[model samples]
Target: MIENIPLLVTNISYGVTFIITVGFGLAVYLKSSRKTAHIMFLFLSLAIGIFQICHVFGINVVDGESSRSIFTGSLSVIFVICFTIHWVLAVLEKDSEKIKTIVGFYTVAVGLVVFYLINPSAFLLNSVPKLYLPNYYEAGNYYWLMFVFFTVGALYAFYTLAHAYRIADPAHKNKLRYFMAAIAIGFPLGSTAFFLALNINIDPIYSTLFSIYIIPLAYGTLRYDVMDIKVVTKKAVSYALIIAGIGFFIAGINWADTLIQSVYTWVPIWAIPLTSSILAVFIGGFVWEKMRDIDILKYEFVTVVTHKFRTPLTRIKWASEMLKKLIPVESADQSRLAVDEIDNANGLLVELTDMLVSLRQVDDINYLYSFEESDMCKIVEKAARNMNKHILDKKIDFSLVCADNIPSVMLDARRMQFALQIVIENAVIYTPEEGRVSVSVTQENGKVVVSIIDTGIGISKEDIDHIFTKFFRSKEAKTTDTEGMGIGLFMAHQIIERHDGDMSVSSDGIGHGSMFKIEVPKA
Candidate 1:
């Protein structure tokens, strides 16, 4: 029993590694499969899981079969390296064509290595029982080639990440640093298995702890917003506590079953599992209902608070208007300026109140919307005119173009104008002084298409997908507009979707520009 302890511990390490790698990979993939980085991570995780499984079985298999099992597992390393490169490039937002070209070359090379690995004789001589691992394989003629391939590929990935980190912005640099640290710890330690293959006789204690890197990797990815994963802290903690409770419950059942069996030997074995299953269902349903109730309460609280804000905002607006009227045009410039400041402050407060109301309505299932046929050009023009003050303040080169034959669209006129204003406002706020903002209204494919383009701090590829997500703000966006709530686009998108229209945005990356297109069906 004592002699088997090392094998047991090693197997446990592999098992834990497999669970964590696959779990995170699946979680990320399920969250956003369209992202190339997520997909590559999933593939890489499966490769690692397969390798671990093979090793787990290889260590327990007969000596004659052990070599084949371990060697077959070795084939997965090629895929691991290939997918790692792809994942890194994707995360770094490398040029798509360049990523394809580089990853394609590695893929072809991996295919060749996979074919070579199939004939184990090309890379493995034989297997021998070792101190830590149950079976350690001896290197054959071309085994060095495997090491070379892995080393070269891993080094290249590390180099790329290091280079990116050096020149990356503050936010991106932190994420890259986390990734680099994780791989730096995981790869080198895990590669100790290669030393064993070369018959160096070193025990792979480091391999047993290789999965430790996942801690930093997961933290960086989730906490730093590496991908567009929106993790609600409350939900995550609640679920974690629930899962822990269930685990404790299961253990308690087992303990009780053992105690009962000791006291009454005739009790049927099926009773414990059956009783536990029923109790689990009951508890799960109870927890789910409670969670739903909590959501309802949260929404209700927000609704009440949002409604309460309207009264003060209206009074402020009225007071500001009165002040503006009381101040004569021929009076001191300071008096006029003071009134203007008050009006501006009031306007900002009103806009915030409106945004809050809209946010509340978005969560209200029974909120009614009035839809009518409204001229798209007029709506666009109105939104632009409303932002004229901002345009003049920034000295922006703003232009509006309306097609002569533009069609009217079915929309809630007030909501649609609000949505348009949100998009136009973002354009004005984000663009630097003297930058250009253009709005065009035209009819295309039986739909009214409104395009708003701006020269601003453009959205990154990663952020563009999540720009419309509630409370999601890009690093640059946050820096550019410190007072932005990050909900305008989200509310606007929701409003447009309710009108059976579509909203989309494109950017040529940061410091370039952005284009937002809204399409609504013609009435």
Candidate 2:
């Protein structure tokens, strides 16, 4: 057995560290902060990760140690050079000088790679006595040049950090100090690994200190909120829990396997399914975290995009109103119709913008809500009035039946109005012409219940379950109204849930109509 315990342990540490650094980079990218410096650092992490993996393989994969070590060692050195240049670029502001330096560095890196490929013996000797693995390469004449290149690149990166620190604003000084300190401590410790190539045979484990390089980045993330990257702390803790659980479960599997083999006559077939289920949980947690992160970015994006679109919409509405006032009374009916259409279009755009903004705020726990004791009957009446035009146009018999002495509920009036409006309007849209759309409010089970029943295309059993999911449109609804964005019920559900209320829908299959009931606590 190749019993190099220390080397094996070092490889394992490298593997774990690589996983961490790479995961952090991916999480940052997934957050959609999209800062250039963040991307550069991610690239730096990736390069080092490749190096660590290669190093592990060099030590463990014995059959091709000679060639593998040389290639991995050489490739790792190149990556170090690449990261060094990228690090400098990340710190410095972009300019003509920066571009020139980048181009020059790229040229030099390419030249060095070509030189190494053509005459690798000048940098690494192919033949050497086996150490712990197989035959390994030794430092050669050109090796100093490669070392000098890495040393220069690293020094420049540190120099850039120091320079940035000196001239930075006082507010930024502490953050830069943290970064400078991390690079100062981490790089030197990691650099000692280069000595191993020179036959110095120093303790190689210090090489893993590269992982410490991320300490400052993480500090920057939490302390300065650097790169505008926001990481939910609880999510991070959850990830830690997930990782620990996976480790514990893996250990348990091994222990169980051993116990079964030793103590029992045969292994149980059920063990495989049990192991798979545990693994599925671990995988599911990881995927769930990713989905949640993406959802955050999605909401932020929605907010920005809707805000941009809202500006033009506001201008259009204002301009159309102004034009209407300027038009003479004797103007043709066509002109009036065109002006009316513009006003209608502008209203739709305004409503859509508001809906997008509200949806974006749905996931935020600290979302502002002005709650007060408001009459539930008055709220529902106002919502029903807002949809009176649509109900009338459809010739639907829409009635608001509110019980006398209906108690007030503590709620955000505007949001509650919006929620109720959505429910009522959806009822008007889906109900067939001349169908009945009735809204009722009453106290039930110590809570105020608002129910909207529509005699129109009903929801199927399968569709009812998913009706409240964002952007989910039932087949019936899609055919009935192709323009529906399918967010009304979703927004209504979110608003009600936030108001300490419950929203549910029931239907007796398609063509039988549906009922939406919302129950909020009475004040």
Candidate 3:
């Protein structure tokens, strides 16, 4: 046992440092605002972290050789399987091919798990406890087959990423580059531990090389926002805590189960109950925090919806009162005015209800609008005209520039018009009185571009990033218009994207003005 001290220390230090770095990476990943490709990455990190903890325990803490072998064999295979899945997903966009890859990986993962359980010794043979840190293992016949499978998977992943990098759009290419660079350098350097499987007796010195991957991973997450993951604050913290809980549980379960042969040899019976009580407190706190977060989000959604409802209800009440008073007057003009007022109020109520319903079920749109191939320039013109009231009220200098012979596009005309109207209305609302708002449409390279430029209180740099997020209102916009629900841009952005187009915003700075740009493929 004395001879194993250095090995114990080395494995403990390596395992602890690796886990901590992975934990930090998980935190950064959870903070992302757009979680597209991030779910796979999260699972990969989690698997590696689990494998490390189990590996360290197998080497230094577990009493029996078979127990240690069982732990390492099961976890190592799982780690490789997750890495393979993450690799395929990170490179491919969501498509039928991606589904195939997922299915293939899952099959392989399940097979490996079954094989390891049936006979862990088949994958992990006799282990030689040594004075040196690296242990010697007798090679199993199936070991090389697993090694070759992983090697091929890693190579295929690199090739797929390279091919994707060559064909990706300019906006996405840089993200692929960052991911590729990290994987290329990190995975091989970290895979050095596999040498032990061949009875090669390689030290775990290169184990920490796995941590280097976190550097580029973080840079991509923070600098490029590559994965487009949205991590709400409360949810992120809760998930982080839960993941940590899981990690502790996995590491502690075996120790607790085989308490007599392991660390519990020195402990008294009373200590077990004390430890259990402490764990219960932690579990209780995690559950309570998650519940509180859910409650907060629910409260916020209800409050905003209630406020929006009140505006239209107030207008309807006023219209009803007017109709009641005018019934006795017997004047045609007064009756006509009351009828028009009621009609307008009903329209507003319908609009508000549709908006809320659409938001709730954004994926379904059959009731929203009819789709057809139509002149996009005409749509832009109509949308701009609908916002004429707000524009004239603000007395803003506005111009609409349209290129001749513009191409037609497939769209739900009324929905697209409503989307564009929302943007233009926002431009008018945010602009100061007498400020300029420019609406321009042009055809370029098989796409039609519509831009709305406004010299208003511009969005702050930080706010511009989240401008299209649901229920997000910038501080500057809030001061200007308290009645705005901050969902207009979100709705508009969603509509534009649903039509296979894109919408983006740019601003120089506050007081410097801003621009909302849209692009759609021509029909």
Clash number by candidate, in order: 0, 0, 9
- Model 2, residue pairs in steric clash: none
lDDT of 1 by residue, 359-413 (tens): 6566455776788888888878877877777899999999999989877778888
Each model's lDDT comes to 0.76, 0.71, 0.68
Q: Best-fitting candidate, measured by lDDT?
A: 1
Predictions ranked by lDDT, top down? Answer: 1, 2, 3
Flag regions of model 2 displaced more than 4 Å.
31-33, 64-70, 127-137, 226-523
How accurate locally is residue 380 in candidate 1, as Cα lDDT from 0 to 100?
A: 82
Candidate number with the higher TM-score (2 or 3): 3
Question: Which residue pairs of candidate 3 clash?
Answer: 32-229, 33-229, 33-230, 34-228, 34-229, 34-230, 35-228, 35-229, 35-230
Model 3 Cα lDDT, one tens digit per residue, 1-523: 3766667676756555555546545655555313445555566666666666556655553345654464554345455545545644643544345777767766786787677668767666655564363443445667665666666666767777788889874545666777788778867766666676565667655655765675566556545332233443335445556656665664575457457546557656566556656776787787878777976786578557857886777778677777767576556665655565565446545555566656545533344555699888888888787666567778999999998888889898877887898888888999999999999999888999999999999987677766876778878888999999877887788788778788988888899889999999898
**Which digits, one per residue and each the tens of the lDDT, describe model 2 over residues 410-521?**
9998778888988988888999999999899989988999999999899886666567766778888999999998777877887897787888788888999889999999
lDDT of 1 at 268: 95
Cα error, candidate 2, residue 215 (Å): 2.4
